[model samples]
Target: MTDLKPRKMDFGFDDADVPFLWNPENPAWSSMSNAVSFLAVGFEKMIVKLIRQAKPLMTDPAVAEEAVAFMRQEGHHSTAHRQHVAALIRRYPGLQNTLDAVIGEYDLLTEATSINYRLAYTADLEATFTPVFKLMLDNEETLFRPGDDRVASLFLWHFVEEVEHRSSALILYKAVVGSELYRMRMAPSVFAHVLKVIRIACAGFNQHVPLGERKVDALSMFARHRAKQRVLTFFAPYLSKGPMPRAFDGLPIGEQLTALKGAALSQTPGHDPAHENLPVLADEWFRRYDAGDDCTRWYTAEPAASGANR
Candidate 1:
């Protein structure tokens, strides 16, 4: 049986006044995570279409089942993220253009790319989530706890679920395409496209959101951007993006390096996401969720208040 379960969540993004800087303590993290919300919507929309196209080609019953469940999960994620993005757009209407542009990139890819190439793209990107999400989940106290409860809870649910089905995309890819070399060959382009989408979202943030609200450059998450900004500050201040701060400067450098190494290894041949180290928070989140905790308000929910709906 497929272990992936699609959990429906309403983060009350519409009811509350969602701030652009949701985590005032870490505006850069808030900005970066907002970009992630934008990326998730477009990327998961592509996943839904990709899986639908691949469904008929899936000969193995198990792989078919996994694909169906994975598709359902991703569909729910896309819906939830759309809500988040809608809230942001309600606040900053110009972001609608940004969302359209991001989705347009994936739409173009679907039209231009082959099924095998799309499968490889999905597999290559999803394989890195186990390690990348672990680094964030492991430091949830700093990365999530201080953020707006709704936004923080949204990411907590999303990341844990990403970890839960970490291997699904690769399994589907291997079942259909079955070319490790092809997957590896596609990694660079897949990641480049991902980064490009993120850049679009960040640049939109800078253009649409005022510096007084965002407090730092939206592109601060990129190390290369920071390096370039540092040189510009010394040489050409007029061309610099304002106040390049990192989303993860508080995180341990070793943990960050480990995540980077793990991400690199994930693209190589014969890498199994099932064998990757998991975050302790994923297990705890599952336990709480299974126990009927109100995960939509992860921090405020009382654990002792049992029998609440998931």
Candidate 2:
């Protein structure tokens, strides 16, 4: 993993003209993903604030700077997702109301919950999402093959950064609470809540797709099966009190950031997020992203329609 400061590369989600079911071949995947984007808008904001709250507690300047960089990346993420969601609202009409309610729910939680609880929630959620993103990265070609490029690129970029900053919350947790046991204890509740939110989001997304399209088919069925296996592989160890295996070491660095517990930060005595040189694939991708090259065509601008509805 590279230790460079996070850069805010806005992928212009506003101008993109994407269908409601961007992945025409797999509306289920598209719906679930849309739900995630809806969650991102508010959830990321809460995470950014939570990270900033831990700034004073961070003694290492490098970690502190990473926190700041993480905030910027998350801020841009929220902005891009918010724009995409607004477009969805325009296309689906009723989506705005559903998402508004969800954001409002987060608002209430933020207001009533203690900071430590919020931080714990953020950390656990990050841990939960780390493996999920790894799965997506692992199966990108199959899942995204028929999806809209703009939407695919948006999520790809988001997941890449998700891998990039996988350790930020853990580092912050150590700085503030200094207890892995607390995190372990909090895991069940956090995972339960995360699942509930995803269910709600999927329900919202499902409403927008036609019933015929929502039916299960060979491709979607296979996708779901693979997705389940990846989830179990990532979480079974922790849940069963067994050894955690590093199943994602060979993935792209962007997806490998949280492969193990998390890439350790330089702020931590022996661990450095930038310890190993990045792989050629990731190093080149970041270079293109930084330079605003056409390699990011899917994200930099609106992409053409994905042929037709399935």
Highest lDDT: which candidate? 1
Taking all chains together, each candidate's TM-score versus the true structure is 0.96, 0.71
lDDT of 2 at 235: 73
**Candidate 2 overall Cα lDDT vs. reference?**
0.61
Clashes of each: 0, 0
TM-score of 1: 0.96
Q: Model 1 scores what on Cα lDDT?
A: 0.93
Query: What is each predicted model's overall lDDT from 0 to 1?
Result: 0.93, 0.61
Compared with the true structure, what per-residue lDDT tens digits does model 1 show for residues 246-297?
8888999999999999999999998999999999999889988988888899
Q: RMSD to the native, candidate 2?
A: 9.8
Least lDDT summed over 10 consecutive residues: which range in candidate 2?
240-249
Estimate, for each residue in 1-310, the C-alpha lDDT of model 2 and write its tens digit.
Answer: 2264555555555676667667766555666677778889878878777776668877888778767777888888888788778888877777777787667767776788767777777766765445566556666665565677767777877777776777776666666776666666666776666655665655555465444543421122233534654577577733221222222223466654544334222222333332433333334445555554543344334322432111
